[model samples]
Target: MNLGIVGQAVGLFAVTNIDDVVVLALFFAQGAGRRHAARNITVGQYVGFAAIVAVAVTAAFGATFLPERVVPYLGLLPLAIGVRAAVRVWRHRGRGGQEEDERTGPGGPRLLEVAAVTFANGGDNIGVYVPVFATAGIVGMSSYVVVFLALLALWIAAGRYFATRPVVARALSRWGHLLLPMVLIGIGVVILVDGGAFGL
Candidate 1:
Protein backbone atom coordinates (compact mmCIF):
# COMPACT_ATOMS: atom_id res chain seq x y z
CA MET A 1 0.00 0.00 0.00
CA ASN A 2 2.90 2.31 0.71
CA LEU A 3 4.24 3.88 -2.46
CA GLY A 4 7.68 4.08 -0.95
CA ILE A 5 7.75 0.41 -0.23
CA VAL A 6 6.50 -0.45 -3.68
CA GLY A 7 9.14 1.71 -5.33
CA GLN A 8 11.88 0.24 -3.21
CA ALA A 9 10.77 -3.27 -4.07
CA VAL A 10 10.67 -2.53 -7.76
CA GLY A 11 14.06 -0.87 -7.75
CA LEU A 12 15.65 -3.63 -5.77
CA PHE A 13 14.26 -6.36 -7.99
CA ALA A 14 15.31 -4.55 -11.13
CA VAL A 15 18.81 -3.81 -9.95
CA THR A 16 19.41 -7.32 -8.72
CA ASN A 17 17.80 -9.13 -11.63
CA ILE A 18 18.75 -7.13 -14.70
CA ASP A 19 21.41 -9.71 -15.51
CA ASP A 20 18.81 -12.41 -15.19
CA VAL A 21 17.10 -11.08 -18.27
CA VAL A 22 20.04 -12.05 -20.42
CA VAL A 23 20.31 -15.42 -18.75
CA LEU A 24 16.65 -16.08 -19.26
CA ALA A 25 16.93 -15.03 -22.87
CA LEU A 26 19.68 -17.54 -23.43
CA PHE A 27 17.53 -20.22 -21.89
CA PHE A 28 14.63 -19.28 -24.11
CA ALA A 29 16.85 -19.37 -27.13
CA GLN A 30 18.07 -22.80 -26.20
CA GLY A 31 14.56 -23.97 -25.57
CA ALA A 32 13.04 -22.41 -28.65
CA GLY A 33 10.51 -24.73 -30.32
CA ARG A 34 11.14 -27.45 -27.80
CA ARG A 35 8.15 -28.98 -26.09
CA HIS A 36 7.57 -27.84 -22.51
CA ALA A 37 10.49 -25.42 -22.71
CA ALA A 38 8.48 -22.38 -21.74
CA ARG A 39 6.62 -24.17 -19.02
CA ASN A 40 9.80 -25.61 -17.53
CA ILE A 41 11.47 -22.23 -17.54
CA THR A 42 8.52 -20.46 -15.96
CA VAL A 43 8.13 -23.03 -13.25
CA GLY A 44 11.84 -23.18 -12.59
CA GLN A 45 12.14 -19.45 -12.28
CA TYR A 46 9.38 -19.32 -9.70
CA VAL A 47 10.74 -22.23 -7.73
CA GLY A 48 14.22 -20.78 -7.67
CA PHE A 49 13.13 -17.27 -6.83
CA ALA A 50 10.77 -18.53 -4.19
CA ALA A 51 13.65 -20.30 -2.50
CA ILE A 52 15.72 -17.15 -2.48
CA VAL A 53 12.91 -15.14 -0.95
CA ALA A 54 12.22 -17.79 1.61
CA VAL A 55 15.83 -17.77 2.70
CA ALA A 56 15.89 -14.02 2.95
CA VAL A 57 12.65 -13.89 4.87
CA THR A 58 13.76 -16.59 7.22
CA ALA A 59 17.04 -14.84 7.87
CA ALA A 60 15.20 -11.58 8.42
CA PHE A 61 13.20 -13.29 11.07
CA GLY A 62 16.41 -14.38 12.83
CA ALA A 63 16.74 -17.89 11.46
CA THR A 64 20.04 -18.81 9.91
CA PHE A 65 19.04 -21.40 7.36
CA LEU A 66 22.27 -20.56 5.64
CA PRO A 67 24.96 -18.97 7.69
CA GLU A 68 26.55 -15.81 6.35
CA ARG A 69 29.94 -17.45 6.17
CA VAL A 70 28.50 -20.18 3.97
CA VAL A 71 26.76 -17.89 1.55
CA PRO A 72 29.74 -17.42 -0.75
CA TYR A 73 30.12 -21.14 -1.24
CA LEU A 74 26.79 -21.00 -2.97
CA GLY A 75 28.79 -19.94 -6.00
CA LEU A 76 29.90 -23.54 -6.30
CA LEU A 77 26.50 -24.50 -7.59
CA PRO A 78 26.79 -22.39 -10.74
CA LEU A 79 30.46 -23.09 -11.13
CA ALA A 80 29.88 -26.81 -11.14
CA ILE A 81 27.02 -26.45 -13.54
CA GLY A 82 29.06 -24.35 -15.92
CA VAL A 83 31.95 -26.75 -15.88
CA ARG A 84 29.66 -29.63 -16.57
CA ALA A 85 28.05 -27.84 -19.46
CA ALA A 86 31.40 -26.98 -20.94
CA VAL A 87 32.54 -30.54 -20.70
CA ARG A 88 29.42 -31.80 -22.40
CA VAL A 89 29.81 -29.35 -25.22
CA TRP A 90 33.37 -30.40 -25.71
CA ARG A 91 32.54 -34.08 -25.78
CA HIS A 92 29.65 -33.70 -28.17
CA ARG A 93 31.26 -31.30 -30.60
CA GLY A 94 31.47 -32.41 -34.26
CA ARG A 95 29.16 -35.28 -33.54
CA GLY A 96 26.64 -34.66 -36.29
CA GLY A 97 23.00 -35.70 -36.09
CA GLN A 98 23.21 -35.14 -32.39
CA GLU A 99 20.33 -32.77 -32.12
CA GLU A 100 18.64 -35.10 -29.75
CA ASP A 101 21.80 -35.30 -27.72
CA GLU A 102 21.97 -31.55 -27.68
CA ARG A 103 18.40 -31.30 -26.54
CA THR A 104 18.32 -34.13 -24.07
CA GLY A 105 21.89 -34.02 -22.97
CA PRO A 106 22.10 -33.41 -19.25
CA GLY A 107 18.34 -33.18 -19.35
CA GLY A 108 18.34 -30.00 -21.50
CA PRO A 109 17.47 -27.04 -19.31
CA ARG A 110 14.71 -28.81 -17.47
CA LEU A 111 12.99 -27.40 -14.44
CA LEU A 112 15.63 -28.59 -12.01
CA GLU A 113 18.48 -27.15 -14.05
CA VAL A 114 16.80 -23.82 -14.45
CA ALA A 115 15.80 -23.75 -10.83
CA ALA A 116 19.33 -24.53 -9.72
CA VAL A 117 20.80 -21.83 -11.91
CA THR A 118 18.20 -19.32 -10.79
CA PHE A 119 18.83 -20.07 -7.18
CA ALA A 120 22.57 -20.02 -7.69
CA ASN A 121 22.35 -16.68 -9.45
CA GLY A 122 20.28 -15.33 -6.57
CA GLY A 123 22.91 -15.56 -3.84
CA ASP A 124 23.47 -11.84 -4.02
CA ASN A 125 19.73 -11.29 -3.99
CA ILE A 126 19.45 -12.95 -0.65
CA GLY A 127 22.09 -10.64 0.72
CA VAL A 128 20.26 -7.63 -0.62
CA TYR A 129 16.86 -8.84 0.49
CA VAL A 130 17.62 -9.91 4.03
CA PRO A 131 18.32 -6.43 5.31
CA VAL A 132 15.41 -4.93 3.46
CA PHE A 133 13.02 -7.53 4.76
CA ALA A 134 14.33 -7.03 8.25
CA THR A 135 13.48 -3.37 8.12
CA ALA A 136 10.13 -3.85 6.39
CA GLY A 137 7.21 -4.67 8.63
CA ILE A 138 5.06 -7.70 7.83
CA VAL A 139 2.79 -5.66 5.55
CA GLY A 140 5.68 -4.15 3.66
CA MET A 141 7.40 -7.48 3.17
CA SER A 142 4.21 -9.03 1.86
CA SER A 143 3.82 -6.22 -0.62
CA TYR A 144 7.36 -6.63 -1.78
CA VAL A 145 6.90 -10.36 -2.28
CA VAL A 146 3.71 -9.87 -4.28
CA VAL A 147 5.31 -7.28 -6.51
CA PHE A 148 8.34 -9.51 -7.01
CA LEU A 149 6.24 -12.51 -8.12
CA ALA A 150 4.18 -10.38 -10.47
CA LEU A 151 7.25 -8.81 -12.02
CA LEU A 152 8.77 -12.25 -12.49
CA ALA A 153 6.19 -12.98 -15.17
CA LEU A 154 7.14 -9.77 -16.90
CA TRP A 155 10.79 -10.72 -16.72
CA ILE A 156 10.10 -14.09 -18.34
CA ALA A 157 8.06 -12.44 -21.04
CA ALA A 158 10.82 -9.97 -21.73
CA GLY A 159 13.36 -12.74 -22.03
CA ARG A 160 11.13 -14.70 -24.37
CA TYR A 161 10.50 -11.63 -26.43
CA PHE A 162 14.19 -10.96 -26.83
CA ALA A 163 14.84 -14.55 -27.73
CA THR A 164 12.10 -14.45 -30.33
CA ARG A 165 13.47 -11.36 -32.05
CA PRO A 166 14.76 -12.06 -35.54
CA VAL A 167 18.43 -11.18 -35.16
CA VAL A 168 18.69 -12.27 -31.54
CA ALA A 169 16.96 -15.53 -32.24
CA ARG A 170 19.32 -16.37 -35.08
CA ALA A 171 22.36 -15.62 -33.01
CA LEU A 172 21.01 -17.57 -30.08
CA SER A 173 20.12 -20.57 -32.19
CA ARG A 174 23.65 -20.67 -33.52
CA TRP A 175 25.56 -19.85 -30.38
CA GLY A 176 23.23 -20.29 -27.45
CA HIS A 177 24.71 -23.60 -26.48
CA LEU A 178 28.17 -22.08 -26.52
CA LEU A 179 27.12 -18.97 -24.71
CA LEU A 180 25.37 -20.86 -21.95
CA PRO A 181 28.49 -22.36 -20.42
CA MET A 182 30.38 -19.10 -20.64
CA VAL A 183 27.62 -17.12 -19.03
CA LEU A 184 27.12 -19.62 -16.27
CA ILE A 185 30.84 -19.80 -15.62
CA GLY A 186 31.15 -16.05 -15.68
CA ILE A 187 28.30 -15.66 -13.23
CA GLY A 188 29.87 -18.22 -10.94
CA VAL A 189 33.24 -16.54 -11.00
CA VAL A 190 31.74 -13.15 -10.33
CA ILE A 191 29.75 -14.43 -7.41
CA LEU A 192 32.80 -16.10 -5.99
CA VAL A 193 34.90 -12.98 -6.32
CA ASP A 194 32.22 -10.71 -4.98
CA GLY A 195 31.53 -12.97 -2.04
CA GLY A 196 35.23 -13.56 -1.44
CA ALA A 197 34.57 -17.26 -1.67
CA PHE A 198 38.02 -18.11 -2.93
CA GLY A 199 39.67 -16.39 -0.03
CA LEU A 200 37.52 -18.31 2.35
Candidate 2:
Protein backbone atom coordinates (compact mmCIF):
# COMPACT_ATOMS: atom_id res chain seq x y z
CA MET A 1 0.00 0.00 0.00
CA ASN A 2 2.27 2.68 -1.24
CA LEU A 3 1.37 6.31 -0.56
CA GLY A 4 2.34 7.06 -4.11
CA ILE A 5 -0.34 4.70 -5.37
CA VAL A 6 -2.91 6.43 -3.19
CA GLY A 7 -1.88 9.84 -4.50
CA GLN A 8 -2.04 8.67 -8.07
CA ALA A 9 -5.47 7.18 -7.49
CA VAL A 10 -6.79 10.41 -6.04
CA GLY A 11 -5.43 12.50 -8.89
CA LEU A 12 -6.65 10.11 -11.54
CA PHE A 13 -10.14 9.92 -10.08
CA ALA A 14 -10.43 13.65 -9.54
CA VAL A 15 -9.34 14.53 -13.04
CA THR A 16 -11.37 11.85 -14.78
CA ASN A 17 -14.51 12.64 -12.80
CA ILE A 18 -14.60 16.39 -12.71
CA ASP A 19 -17.69 16.36 -14.91
CA ASP A 20 -19.34 13.98 -12.54
CA VAL A 21 -19.76 16.85 -10.12
CA VAL A 22 -22.02 18.58 -12.60
CA VAL A 23 -23.93 15.41 -13.38
CA LEU A 24 -24.38 14.60 -9.73
CA ALA A 25 -25.57 18.12 -9.08
CA LEU A 26 -28.24 17.63 -11.72
CA PHE A 27 -29.39 14.39 -10.17
CA PHE A 28 -29.42 15.91 -6.71
CA ALA A 29 -31.46 18.82 -8.00
CA GLN A 30 -34.08 16.31 -9.03
CA GLY A 31 -34.27 15.22 -5.42
CA ALA A 32 -37.13 16.28 -3.21
CA GLY A 33 -34.66 18.04 -0.94
CA ARG A 34 -34.75 15.07 1.33
CA ARG A 35 -32.08 12.95 2.97
CA HIS A 36 -33.43 9.80 1.42
CA ALA A 37 -32.93 11.28 -2.02
CA ALA A 38 -29.31 12.07 -1.27
CA ARG A 39 -28.81 8.67 0.27
CA ASN A 40 -30.21 6.95 -2.78
CA ILE A 41 -27.97 8.96 -5.04
CA THR A 42 -24.94 8.01 -2.97
CA VAL A 43 -25.86 4.37 -3.00
CA GLY A 44 -26.50 4.43 -6.71
CA GLN A 45 -23.16 6.06 -7.40
CA TYR A 46 -21.44 3.41 -5.33
CA VAL A 47 -23.19 0.64 -7.16
CA GLY A 48 -22.33 2.04 -10.57
CA PHE A 49 -18.73 2.78 -9.61
CA ALA A 50 -18.38 -0.67 -8.11
CA ALA A 51 -19.52 -2.18 -11.35
CA ILE A 52 -16.97 -0.18 -13.30
CA VAL A 53 -14.20 -1.12 -10.89
CA ALA A 54 -15.12 -4.77 -11.15
CA VAL A 55 -14.86 -4.70 -14.92
CA ALA A 56 -11.71 -2.62 -14.87
CA VAL A 57 -10.07 -4.92 -12.37
CA THR A 58 -10.99 -7.91 -14.48
CA ALA A 59 -9.48 -6.31 -17.53
CA ALA A 60 -6.41 -5.44 -15.51
CA PHE A 61 -5.97 -9.05 -14.56
CA GLY A 62 -6.27 -10.17 -18.20
CA ALA A 63 -9.63 -11.74 -17.48
CA THR A 64 -10.95 -9.42 -20.17
CA PHE A 65 -9.54 -7.29 -22.91
CA LEU A 66 -11.58 -4.17 -23.47
CA PRO A 67 -9.40 -2.61 -26.12
CA GLU A 68 -8.60 1.08 -26.07
CA ARG A 69 -10.52 1.42 -29.33
CA VAL A 70 -13.68 0.56 -27.47
CA VAL A 71 -13.24 3.48 -25.07
CA PRO A 72 -14.65 6.15 -27.39
CA TYR A 73 -17.67 4.05 -28.32
CA LEU A 74 -18.71 3.95 -24.68
CA GLY A 75 -19.54 7.61 -25.08
CA LEU A 76 -22.69 6.62 -26.92
CA LEU A 77 -24.31 5.48 -23.69
CA PRO A 78 -24.32 9.00 -22.24
CA LEU A 79 -25.12 10.55 -25.61
CA ALA A 80 -28.30 8.52 -25.87
CA ILE A 81 -29.22 9.41 -22.32
CA GLY A 82 -28.73 13.09 -22.99
CA VAL A 83 -30.82 12.90 -26.16
CA ARG A 84 -33.60 11.24 -24.20
CA ALA A 85 -33.49 13.95 -21.56
CA ALA A 86 -33.59 16.64 -24.21
CA VAL A 87 -36.55 15.03 -25.91
CA ARG A 88 -38.37 14.65 -22.64
CA VAL A 89 -37.92 18.30 -21.85
CA TRP A 90 -38.94 19.37 -25.31
CA ARG A 91 -42.11 17.28 -25.31
CA HIS A 92 -43.20 18.33 -21.85
CA ARG A 93 -41.89 21.85 -21.72
CA GLY A 94 -39.92 20.90 -18.60
CA ARG A 95 -43.10 20.05 -16.73
CA GLY A 96 -42.29 16.40 -17.31
CA GLY A 97 -44.60 13.41 -17.55
CA GLN A 98 -45.64 10.92 -14.91
CA GLU A 99 -42.18 9.43 -15.01
CA GLU A 100 -40.65 12.80 -14.39
CA ASP A 101 -43.08 13.45 -11.60
CA GLU A 102 -42.05 10.18 -10.03
CA ARG A 103 -38.45 11.21 -10.24
CA THR A 104 -39.02 14.44 -8.35
CA GLY A 105 -41.64 13.36 -5.87
CA PRO A 106 -41.41 12.32 -2.24
CA GLY A 107 -40.65 8.73 -3.05
CA GLY A 108 -37.21 9.81 -4.20
CA PRO A 109 -34.98 8.48 -6.97
CA ARG A 110 -34.92 4.81 -7.77
CA LEU A 111 -31.64 3.00 -7.23
CA LEU A 112 -31.61 1.61 -10.73
CA GLU A 113 -32.11 4.99 -12.38
CA VAL A 114 -29.29 6.60 -10.43
CA ALA A 115 -27.07 3.59 -10.96
CA ALA A 116 -27.67 3.61 -14.71
CA VAL A 117 -26.84 7.30 -14.97
CA THR A 118 -23.76 6.90 -12.84
CA PHE A 119 -22.55 3.97 -14.88
CA ALA A 120 -23.24 5.75 -18.14
CA ASN A 121 -21.43 8.80 -16.86
CA GLY A 122 -18.36 6.73 -16.02
CA GLY A 123 -17.92 5.25 -19.47
CA ASP A 124 -14.63 7.09 -19.75
CA ASN A 125 -13.60 6.07 -16.29
CA ILE A 126 -13.23 2.49 -17.42
CA GLY A 127 -10.75 3.51 -20.06
CA VAL A 128 -8.62 5.47 -17.63
CA TYR A 129 -8.83 2.91 -14.86
CA VAL A 130 -8.08 -0.27 -16.81
CA PRO A 131 -4.59 0.81 -17.72
CA VAL A 132 -3.89 2.26 -14.31
CA PHE A 133 -4.97 -0.92 -12.60
CA ALA A 134 -3.03 -3.07 -15.01
CA THR A 135 0.11 -1.16 -14.30
CA ALA A 136 -0.42 -1.28 -10.58
CA GLY A 137 -0.01 -4.65 -8.94
CA ILE A 138 -2.71 -5.93 -6.57
CA VAL A 139 -1.30 -3.95 -3.67
CA GLY A 140 -1.25 -0.80 -5.77
CA MET A 141 -4.69 -1.50 -7.14
CA SER A 142 -6.03 -2.02 -3.66
CA SER A 143 -4.63 1.29 -2.52
CA TYR A 144 -6.01 3.01 -5.56
CA VAL A 145 -9.48 1.60 -5.04
CA VAL A 146 -9.46 2.68 -1.43
CA VAL A 147 -8.52 6.24 -2.25
CA PHE A 148 -11.03 6.39 -5.06
CA LEU A 149 -13.87 5.12 -2.92
CA ALA A 150 -13.02 7.70 -0.30
CA LEU A 151 -13.03 10.47 -2.88
CA LEU A 152 -16.32 9.17 -4.23
CA ALA A 153 -17.93 10.25 -0.98
CA LEU A 154 -16.55 13.73 -1.50
CA TRP A 155 -18.24 13.82 -4.92
CA ILE A 156 -21.59 13.01 -3.37
CA ALA A 157 -21.13 15.68 -0.77
CA ALA A 158 -20.11 18.26 -3.33
CA GLY A 159 -23.16 17.42 -5.39
CA ARG A 160 -25.41 17.85 -2.39
CA TYR A 161 -23.78 21.17 -1.64
CA PHE A 162 -24.40 22.36 -5.19
CA ALA A 163 -28.02 21.23 -5.04
CA THR A 164 -28.58 23.25 -1.88
CA ARG A 165 -27.16 26.40 -3.39
CA PRO A 166 -30.20 28.27 -4.63
CA VAL A 167 -28.41 29.90 -7.55
CA VAL A 168 -26.85 26.68 -8.84
CA ALA A 169 -29.91 24.58 -8.19
CA ARG A 170 -32.24 27.05 -9.89
CA ALA A 171 -29.91 27.33 -12.85
CA LEU A 172 -29.62 23.59 -13.21
CA SER A 173 -33.32 23.07 -12.78
CA ARG A 174 -34.12 25.72 -15.33
CA TRP A 175 -31.50 24.89 -17.97
CA GLY A 176 -30.42 21.33 -17.23
CA HIS A 177 -32.69 20.04 -19.96
CA LEU A 178 -30.60 21.74 -22.62
CA LEU A 179 -27.30 21.71 -20.78
CA LEU A 180 -27.24 18.05 -19.84
CA PRO A 181 -27.69 16.81 -23.37
CA MET A 182 -25.07 19.12 -24.72
CA VAL A 183 -22.63 18.08 -22.06
CA LEU A 184 -23.20 14.40 -22.72
CA ILE A 185 -22.75 14.74 -26.45
CA GLY A 186 -19.71 16.88 -25.90
CA ILE A 187 -18.14 14.27 -23.67
CA GLY A 188 -18.69 11.64 -26.33
CA VAL A 189 -17.08 13.75 -28.99
CA VAL A 190 -14.10 14.44 -26.76
CA ILE A 191 -13.56 10.74 -26.13
CA LEU A 192 -13.76 9.95 -29.81
CA VAL A 193 -11.32 12.67 -30.71
CA ASP A 194 -8.97 12.12 -27.81
CA GLY A 195 -8.79 8.42 -28.45
CA GLY A 196 -8.66 8.93 -32.20
CA ALA A 197 -11.17 6.13 -32.22
CA PHE A 198 -12.10 6.86 -35.84
CA GLY A 199 -8.44 7.13 -36.80
CA LEU A 200 -9.25 10.46 -38.36
Best model number under TM-score: 1
**What would the per-residue lDDT of candidate 2 be over residues 89-179, giving only the tens digit for each residue?**
6886745565455654464445766676677668668877888899888988988888989999999999889877889878876775567
lDDT of each: 0.88, 0.76
Candidate 2 achieves a global lDDT of: 0.76
TM-score of each model, in listed order: 0.93, 0.79
Candidate number achieving the greatest lDDT relative to the actual structure = 1
Off by over 4 Å in 1: 96-107
Across residues 67-152, which tens digit of lDDT does each residue of candidate 1 receive? 87777777788788889889988987888567645564344578988898899899778988998999997999999999999899
Q: In model 2, where is the ten-residue run with the lowest total lDDT? A: 101-110
User: What lDDT score goes with residue 94 in model 1?
Assistant: 84
